[model samples]
Target: VNQLGIGNYLNFKDRLRHKNGKLKYVEGSAHRLDAQNIQVMFNDVTSRVVAEQQIAEERNFVFHSLDVMPGIFYVINHEGRFLRWNRQTEEISGYTAEELRHITSAEMIAPELRAKHKEFVASILSGARWEGEAELCCKDGRRIPYYYVVRHFKWQGEDCVVGMGVDLTERNQAERLALTYLKEMQSLSARILESQEEERRRIARELHDELGQGLTATLLSLKNAEEQMGESPMVAQVKHASSIITILTQQVRALSLNLRPSVLDDLGLVAAFRWYIRERVESAGLRVVLSVDKDLPRLPALQETACFRVLQSAFTNILRHAQAQEAQVSLRQADGNLVLVIHDNGRGFDVKAARQTALAGKSLGLLGMEERVRLVGGVLEITSAPGQGSEVRVVLPMG
Candidate 1:
């Protein structure tokens, strides 16, 4: 009232006592009609004022909730201007709220990823929900991996993108750790397999050289004694003893060969495969066709050993379980890799079931073959189904 003068008007909102004695909000205007008289008008605005206050309170609550969230939450306009963001956005970016308001979303992404980020934003603005992983560049020169999901929506009648980003630092670290452990385990497995082969070879050599020769010499001595007996009662007993020793010698020789075929070490993989096919597969009544590339070069010792063992295991499974009549084995060099394939025409078993059984330790032949191939940095694939033949294929890098 004191500020108002003639030809001057003032507008204000004030609290006034209503007829019921409750306080009410009023919007009022006053104008001095003359120096001695003034005109005044007032209108109730209580409802509007209350609604505005409630909206402000709700908005504050929403912001507080977003700040408490673990992941990054943000809303950006189609022009990439930051409209809203959670506390994590500022914390992770090493930027203050006021600084973030001045920068575009692309500026927060790694420089090399800016183009890709733009494309992703465009996809969201085109009404497609997008999710992907990217590295976020911080003000402190740190790059943090994040996976984000974003969608386009309307906020306050303007195009906006709302998104949530999860930090992938822990996940990436865990993945790397797991991969390192896996490599270590694979290295250990390879060493174990190599040691096992070495032991087997040593045992086979001893059996063949020492035990086998002793049995043979013993049989020869018995034969000489029988010849000198001259129809005596001891002659028949000597002959019987010689016959038993001969059988024992043959059994020992067979065991030595089975343990680690001398041909594998003396003649190379192809010759060894041929010997095994003729001596083992054919002996089991399974007709086998062997194919070899004439130009196949001798591989590294470990590679050759792995391939032979895989082939040996596959054939063992076929003979014991496949009940097949015909089989085919092929060894060749293709695309800088040593390829070995064994196919058998027989009643095949469920490959998935067999793998599960092997995992449970009920079956080990399939697992053994797979491990041998993997130890040499190779891939082994077995395809089989009931009533259909099985094929085991191995591809080992020549390098």
Candidate 2:
């Protein structure tokens, strides 16, 4: 009687779908059955239905996201084996999931970092999320840079750690190339400046010993001739000519000295700078102090010249830019390198402005300083700010 009415009014499949879809299970009909049997049946059916639905959802998420996402997806089991990975991993690594599953995670890490990789994996399984940039090897026998992101998770009823990685090979290579280009530019600039200083010194020498003395002798001869022609109608004109000649000679000698200081090549860098500094201090009406390591023996001629040129540029800048009344120059030896420092208590200029000038056509002074330092493998640094004094430092390896 119950079967006939229910068959016409209700379907068993429909009833089962409604109950199972909503609650993942259905209760057995109450009759005079054993309590243990009913409870056992209920527990088994509910567990299976809930697990099946969860698995379906996870499969849907993985299948839909695998090819669509930009990065590779992966899962590792508690035994440190590759349980599953998305199709995209094959596309990126050139190894199908079937082949990857046979290999250990250690095979993916670069040899240099293999120990570190193992350590990291151990830590992650112990409840740490290990992530950093790592290198990846491609199927084409190429090593590429990649960004690795790994986390702790559960897989197949066991705790595991999984990771996703993105290719950063191109971006990292471009950055490295840019840095290499910058270093090359700086090196070339230094060389150019060093050559320019050598040319300047050569020109200064030609002017001093060759041109200046010749002009001085000519003016002295004119003076004696004019003195003998006194009281003549041309006497006033002769006196004027003599006066002009004397001035011209003086100007030529001064110009020659300014072009290249003879003291620099004659004495070493220290003595040369001391003389130059003294002259500058007197001319600027400012006090100047000099401190040098007395025990520091004479360095290589070329090295000393470079140091002198650095000092020369610093004082030239000081005279032009620094507005302070006192300046200090110190040369010391420390850590097997010669350190030259020039500090001036004068009006300072913007450091960025100076660097920009170095970048521009007018950056000759800074470039020249850098060039001289570079010839002997030295480094020059300038520090200054508005209203603060400027400091110039050069460090040259003694070798």
Candidate 3:
């Protein structure tokens, strides 16, 4: 019956190849002796030979390519059962094809990685490609990192997983170590900045309270003596000397304040900022307003300093770049957050341009401000456009 079914194929193509042009195409099963089946059968036989050769060539190519890889290659059914593995898989997994075929995917992988592997398999079998890096236990119980690419496919009409994996244990470890070192360096930077700020506060306090007051008193005493002398031979010299000393004392006081304001320690962040705004803004010839929430709890030392430093930098920007006539600094607690806003009626430039200025050696002051805010787990937002004033807002999480 099988031979009868295809016997007409022999003459079908022979009628076209070697015989006269009396050949016509037919589509059913067998033809009678009036039309030869010899050509048809011969053509069908030739087609099968070519098809088999193409399949053999394709199989050879795939297997040869996989064999040359320095990784494991595998095909598994949707149920996580192995279908095939190349020679490289044996070298990597220490399991022969027969041995692997006897094992399920979970049996070869360690107990710990089994669940994750199953998840990957399930995701891939459901028509998604899975690509990932993971540590898997080898046949000798040694864990190794592998980078894998899994593709969903159909093998013999059944859903299957096909994938290749390269060992990445050494390179992956190097990257992890490098990342750890970088984090350590960053932590050291944060701590160094913290310590530097603490030391600055100490020095500023000493200069303001001890050296600053002593010089101020000395200048006042010299002035009094000059007045009492009332035209002595050295009166002119002493009067001139007293005025010089007074000027020097005031400049030194300003330097100390710039280093770290004593009011920041004595009166808390709000009062210190209030004095700062009044002096710095007025000195810059800008009208300034200060508002502090009436009844707010004391903030942690770190948070207060961060907030104050941000405000200080903002005002400095106003004086140096804003060229504004008025500014406002507001500190308040609303919705369980510390909100600080600095607004100025200045000639605002594009923030991107301001950043480029920092890039061009004109300080944005934003890096310092952002670093401080990030250190305290707070967020700082800067908004500005050309011809539009800048609003710097800081939202600090409260504890």
**After superposition, candidate 2 runs with Cα above 4 Å error:** 1-73, 129-131, 154-158, 233-236, 300-302, 347-376, 383-388
Stretches of model 3 off by over 4 angstroms after superposition: 1-55, 86-88, 108-137, 142-148, 165-175, 334-337, 345-347, 350-364, 397-399
Residue lDDT tens for model 3, 246-328: 88888878888888888887778888887887777686688888888898777888888899899989988888888888888
**Model 2: per-residue lDDT, tens digit, 106-220?**
7666778766666777788889876778877766667777788889987767788888888787788899999899789877865675576577778777776777677767767
Q: Which candidate leads the pack in lDDT?
A: 1
In every candidate, how many clashes are there? 0, 2, 16
Q: Which candidate number has the best TM-score?
A: 1
C-alpha RMSD in Å of predicted model 3 compared with the true structure: 6.7
Which pairs of residues clash in candidate 1, taking residues 3 or more apart in a chain or in different chains? none
Displacement of residue 281 (Cα, Å) in model 1 is 1.5
Candidate 3 displacement at residue 185 in angstroms: 2.1
| Candidate 1 Cα misplacement greater than 4 A, ranges | 1-62, 115-120
All candidates: TM-score: 0.84, 0.75, 0.75
Ranking by lDDT: 1, 3, 2
Q: What is the C-alpha local distance difference test score of each model?
A: 0.90, 0.75, 0.79
What is the lDDT for 105 in model 3?
74
